[model samples]
Target: MASSSSSTKTDPSAQGQAATQQRLTEAWVRLAKQLTSSKDYQDIASLVAKTDVLALKNEKLERELQDALTAETRNLNAIQEVKNENMAMEDACRQKESQVEAAQMKESQAQSQLQKAQEEVAVLKQELDSNASKITETVNSKLEKEVQIRRLTEEMEKMAESFRQTEADLKKTNQANMGQLKMAVDATTEELNTLKALATPLKPQADKRIPSLEAIEHDV
Candidate 1:
């Protein structure tokens, strides 16, 4: 009897709990249907779709921005490289200019030295020419002296031959006239003394000696 009494009490409470659960389920179903049919829900759905499109556009923009930044970085690097190359080229140009200047200076010095050498050579040539002229003049003077000596010698030889012939003629005429022979002998002696005076300067060079006045007179 106690068990039957406890069972009858739990059945009414169970029925009440089941009826409350059914009511809560019906309220949830009604709220869900209202939310699906509302304009706000459709607007939210549209907003979600637009947000997705905006996100995709933002992503594409970010990618394009990254590409642009990369390109800018590359351009900046290229510019720096070009600047460095320009600086190197400028340095090289300056070095070349300095080298050219140095070479030009050396060339100028060489030219100056060459000019000095040429001037020295010209002076030396002038000296050599002057010396050669002086030598030629001295040689010509020596030749003229030799010729004069030879002429003097020949004249002396001719005079000596004339004196010998005159002596021979005087010898032949000595028997014809003694007084005329004495006068001729005196005249021949005077002429021979004059010739001896004239030939005194050439005595060192003459191969033949003039006959002495005493010897000529003795021969006469």
Candidate 2:
């Protein structure tokens, strides 16, 4: 009876060790996900069909990786767009610089033409002034010639009036001497024949004065 009672007491210790082993098995199965429970075994078809926890978690990870790849692609595209805009702006600046160079060349040509035109105007003005001075000198010479002609004509007319007055005084003195000579000739009529013979010498000198007007005008 003592050995049998001792075995019964030892059986309670064995039961306690068995209970601890059962809890360790359950904790290991829960941590490592072993398909141990009969209910877990039966639920496999339902879990796989509904996309159980493992597959759902893998799908979420894959989705996050794909979104990260898409964001990287967008950043690269923005950098390329900025590079293209900078190239366009540089091309526009080159075209503006070319246009400014062309404008400067045209301005230089205009300035040269203006300087040539100014030189031509100055030459023309000098020629005009020279011609005006020549014309003034010619007019002054013509005026002096006209004044000299008027003075010469007045002197000629005064000399002709002095000659006319001298000729009229000589004609009156000759007529008075002829009247005294005729009265003396009548008082000596008896001696007139002999006196007339002496007067015959004066007859040739008187006949010389009675020359024709045509002969007198020809002598003058």
Best by lDDT: 1
- Residue 199's lDDT within candidate 1 is 47
Error of 2 at 102 (Å): 1.1
lDDT (C-alpha, whole model) for all candidates:
0.75, 0.57
**The 10-residue segment with the lowest total lDDT in model 1:** 201-210
135-186 in candidate 2: lDDT tens per residue? 6766554454334333433433343333233323434556464333333333
Best by TM-score: 1
Candidate 2 lDDT:
0.57
Tens-digit lDDT string for candidate 1 (1-220): 9988887675788899999999999999998788778999789889999999999999999999999999999999999999999999999999999999999999999999999999999999999999999989877666665565556556655655666576577568664554554465456546555655654554534434445546656765
Off by over 4 Å in 2: 1-72, 145-220
How far out, in Å, is residue 163 in model 1? 9.1
Which residue pairs collide in model 1, if any?
A: none
